[model samples]
Target: MSYEEILLETEEKMEKAATVFSDELKGIRTGRATPGLIENIRADYYGSPTPLKQMASISVPEPRMLVVKPFDVSVIKSIEKAILKSDLGMTPNSDGKILRLQVPALSEERRKQIVNQVKDLAEKAKISIRNIRRDSNRQADQLEKKSEISEDDCKSLKDEIQELTKKFEDKVNEYFDKKQKEILEK
Candidate 1:
């Protein structure tokens, strides 16, 4: 509606892009076990697809192992089946009630592939942030044309939006670098 509103919207979207990138990076496999990898998986629960976190309690008893204890023992088989079918590539060792997944070490090639994927994701986030900046700048121009905002106000708003974009882009780059290090660590 106004230049200030446009800037706020742009800032909000930039932050959202950063948050999304961070969440996705958590799912990338590394050298250790973490709840983020499988917590969002959709497992068949009585003909309905449910998030694994809701169906089971996941814990990392060791650095390389994940113990998944289902709230309903009857769902253990379903959970196992889901994990087997998923791209996690880890075998599920089920013992009637609880399931264990042994997270394996990533090969050098796999680590490189994952790093490339992270780079791609980071690029996409940056592009999205840039697009938001463009749209906000365009809106500011429109407000100036309509005399709702002075040219000086529009210029200031665009500058603020650009700063927000740079801040979020840096955040995305920071996430990429951190994840890359985690994936490559021995």
Candidate 2:
């Protein structure tokens, strides 16, 4: 493949890594209610397992409260159980129909802990982007060795790939910083 193709592919892969990191950070809750926080919960409905989002309609009735109304009222117990079992550290209140989750404000220590988790996720995303750059650089070298591109071309491609890596790494850091602010904010 041409160097341009290689660089484009590298960028796409890095973007994917960043998107995955952002998605993971969504599961880490702040002091407010967002559907993403609880939708990921896998509820045991009868003998089948399903995501809460698929089993019910989740809404934010208040800034701190989330209402989960199941399509089938029979699954209420299981949905409540699944949420209680999740690591969100919140309890679900059900009135035999809809389950309400009250999201309490996080303690200072808990916010710090969540920030640390975001840091870890950002680090992993950087590592993935670097790995992609490394693989792309290796491919560039292979092309040069096969006489498909000149030695000078390979050097330029390597430099370009490093630039792309730095760009994506910065994007990951930006995401972490934004999330941290959200978590630490009241």
Q: Identify the candidate with maximal lDDT.
A: 2
- Candidate 2, residues 1-186, lDDT tens digits: the string is 998999999999999999999999888999889999989899998798899999999999899999999999999999988998997888998999999889999999999998998898899999999999999999999999999999999999999999999999999999999999999999
Candidate 1, residues 75-186, lDDT tens digits: the string is: 8989998888889999999899899999999999999998999999999999999998998888889999999999889889988998999999999999999999999997
Q: How accurate is candidate 1 locally (lDDT)?
A: 0.92
Error of 1 at 78 (Å): 0.9
Q: What value does the lDDT take at residue 120 in candidate 2?
A: 89
- Which residue runs of candidate 1 sit more than 4 Å off their true CA positions? none
User: How far in Å is the alpha carbon of 74 misplaced in model 2?
Assistant: 1.5
Off by over 4 Å in 2: none
